[model samples]
Target: MPRPFVIDCALSFAVAVSTVLTSVIAGGQAEQSPPDWVGYLLLTVAAAFLVARRRFPPLVMVLTMLVSLLYFGLGFGTGAFTVAPALAVYTAITAKHRIAGSAGAAGYLAVVLLADRVGGQRDVSEGNVWMVIWILVIVVVGEVSRGRAEHLRAVAEQAARAELTRELEAQRRADQERLRIARELHDVLAHNISVISIQAGVAEHLMHRDPDKAHAAVATIRQVTKDVLVELRSILDVLRRVDEAGEIFPPSGVEGIERLAGRAAAGGIAVDLDVRGRASEVPADVGLVAYRVVQESLTNVIRHSRAAHASVVVNVDDTEVLVRVRDDGRGVPGDDVRAGNGIAGMTERVEAMSGTITAAPADGRGFVVEARLPLRRPEP
Candidate 1:
């Protein structure tokens, strides 16, 4: 298909045509002239088969070889017809037909010799044999070069596809991270900001009439903002890489319940925590999810309930971790299930860890949230 191959094939055809015409012209002038035109015609057809060598090599090569043998038997110019078998030799090698190619070459030589012997032509020389061998060598080398080029092309295409796949995967991961950040900002930061805004307005109104209580309200706003900063940092740290050397913080776990309880207490929601478990053995990711579920559940209670006190009970066993949060306040109606983002977020976190959550009010009292998470840890 290349310019050089096209040129070469064209030239070979022209030569074969010239040989046929010359043999015909000579035979017309004299009866002893070799009747090699038939051989030249067969050789020309065989050489042209190279055009489809890449697409159907085995079939083309076989047909061409058969024509070349017939040409040789008819005593068409041995020299020109020799190109046919030689070209077949090249195609065979190119098609990775080592045994077939070699065997064909040997069979061709045997046929040429046997034909000459059977025809009683004892004057045939060995120069033709040398010429055919040289041609075969050149064709074999050309086929080798072509095979190498094809291999290199395949490798380049494979590498390009792999690179494209990697880039797409990376882009998909970035999009997912952005979605996660948006969800966290909407659920956690937005709720905290709303609470801070309402409390700040109350403090401003009470400043002249109730100075001590106003001061206490300002302190509550400051503490809430501080807690917001810590959580915001946790989210941002994933992007900022504050700790270049390693992970920034040990993952928040069941042990973190105490701090979470203290924060709720500071915000005027008395929270009592009773932890019973081998909290240290939980998977970091699962522990984080469990802790967030409790934190978010308590946040909802503080924002929605007029309950004076909330209790969190953590029970960890060999197979699973169970969390229960109950409050003593106005209860939801049995038939009226009020669904909110807080409950949805807790459910999402628990489900992500192969866990389940149940939300309902305690008998004749307040709301209760419970989650059960399976225990599965990766080896360090």
Candidate 2:
């Protein structure tokens, strides 16, 4: 399933297959030359057992080393140079079962020397130095293979852990994105829907008493509801298919201020909009920040303010876009405004875009939210 596991499995399979094929060839040689086939057959069986050496190292070593002794007993000198048992020793050592490997090594040396003494019909003093040299080579290879396998396994484990961390981080980000979309939908549609619902009920109650006046109120409700649905769908479409091309638009720029004014007018909050300098000079992201600042400010006015009037001013200089929203209302409730993350969130967005926001109750009356956003994208 994962890369490291897949690679390890393939490598282990290859090693096992290779060991079996090599053992069959070495086993055939023993059968052809030796008179006592029993000892040679035992050596062949031991070598074949090496295929599962890693999974059952200590057992494989004991069984294979005993077979090696029997082959030596039957006068089979030197040869296969039995790479299989050497592999078994390597497996045992890598698994940190070095004591088992050491025991196998000691037993192998004893058998080789004893065989030479018995078969040659000679003294122990006349034993071949080459047998000792071969044993040393086996030990060296075993140590090297053990170290390599350990290093490879450690690296594989580290890689798997890193991959898992990345996957978890991606999932966390996806969850956060979903929450962002939900918050936007709730903030934008909920307030407007509340107003429309109340106004619709009022119009229904006055239908017979004041038909013409009631008709105007009903029309306003329809217009307000339609506008909310259109914008709601626009926001949802952006959330549902962020990956799709052509879904993007210039959001929260000069056009956004006009839309904000229109929405406030519909909600019975008279707004005066003032624009200065080049309106189109702001970057798209900065424009979006400007839009959000105005949007949140107006939304707060409708929901929290007692005053029926607000003023919006946009100043686009050479380097920055400054937006100011002032309301002639009993200044914003400190605790509610602070507890609501809207203002703080607006500041965060501005800072992320390399900008700043300041909000305070005006000197004599009402409240003001002013934001200065850089026209250029921040350096990466």
Candidate 3:
């Protein structure tokens, strides 16, 4: 059986035993003792009904009150015999049946007062006063218990809601982190693959017609492949053990744009890199964003733009870094400038650092990609 049911059974049994003891003791004190069976039967029924008090508190109170009245009607005095019914009153009140509990208490008090008057026993007024005091005590105790139970219930509900909120926030942050990692992998692999593709095509075209040019192209491919593998290893290391605090890849910034331009030149696209303002003073994340914007822009130029030349401009101030990548190639339509994964990836990185990016065709010429990234970190 459940623990609460065991406790209720014990309480009910105690009440029944106490009622019988009271009746026996009181009968011995009476001038002429009445038969014991009627009192015992009435108190026993009242006490037994209390076992189900939590399930039907008001019903138990009513049944106990009726049994108590019958006991009094049979000339049995109200001594500890009232204990069982009093407990029923408390049970009803604690179950939040206030109106029924109050009414039951009032009716019980009236019955005790009437019983006293009808008996014409000595000091009847004193007995009635004592009855009222006891009833008030029971009501106050029941109300206090109800208040405490309600307070505990409300506290439990608030705790459950707080836990759910914390779990949802954790899941949301994990999703964002996963997306950031995927974007990094895409950017790294895409640039390397584009370089390898251009180099491979050059080596293949010159392999027979010009042996020296083909050998150089093959050398370029080897260097680019080695560099790509190093970067890929760094990315994989970070993925394998994310909690480690060491640097995953070599630090990349706007200064690396020179090496990028050289690689683009080797791929047969002449790149002009221009710097203005204090580029070295830019924050690491801002500088990295500037580098990525230029890298992706040039990759696009080599793959799509048939024109021979592209220009990269990097300007920095005390507060922000500004970047522009323009190509003198067959420009895309304005409507076709909408975000694909590459453009969307750039936009996500910039906006995450509180920056802005715009990509569109240049006036009467090739395509342009411009970005402005804040030097200082943004507030959460």
Q: Which candidate achieves the best TM-score against the true structure?
A: 3
Write model 1 residue lDDT over 319-378, tens digit each, in one string: 999999998978666565446666776777777677889889888789998999989743
Q: Each prediction's Cα lDDT score?
A: 0.71, 0.71, 0.82
Per-residue alpha-carbon lDDT of model 3 for 1-380, expressed as tens digits? 56877888889898888888777876777553453787788888888988898889999999988988888777776456567778888989999998889899998988778777777766657656876888888988999998999999999999999999999999998899898778777777777678778989988999999989989988988988887787777777777875556435556687777777877887888889899898777778777788888878888888877868999999888878889999999987766676457888889889988999999888878999999999887677
- Between prediction 1 and prediction 3, the one with superior lDDT is 3
Give the winner by lDDT. Answer: 3
Query: Taking the tens digit of each residue's C-alpha lDDT, what string does model 2 give over 277-370?
Result: 8887667767777887888888777767766899999999998888999998998656556677678767767787888888888778889999
Q: What is the lDDT of candidate 1?
A: 0.71
Q: Considering summed lDDT, which 10 consecutive residues are worst modelled in model 3?
A: 242-251
- Please tell me which model should have the higher TM-score, number 2 or number 3: 3
Which residue runs does candidate 1 get wrong by more than 4 Å? 1-45, 55-63, 85-191, 244-251, 266-268, 277-284, 304-308, 316-320, 328-344, 360-365, 378-380
* TM-score, model 3 to reference: 0.85
Which residue pairs collide in model 1, if any?
36-76, 36-77
TM-score of 1: 0.66
State TM-scores per candidate: 0.66, 0.65, 0.85
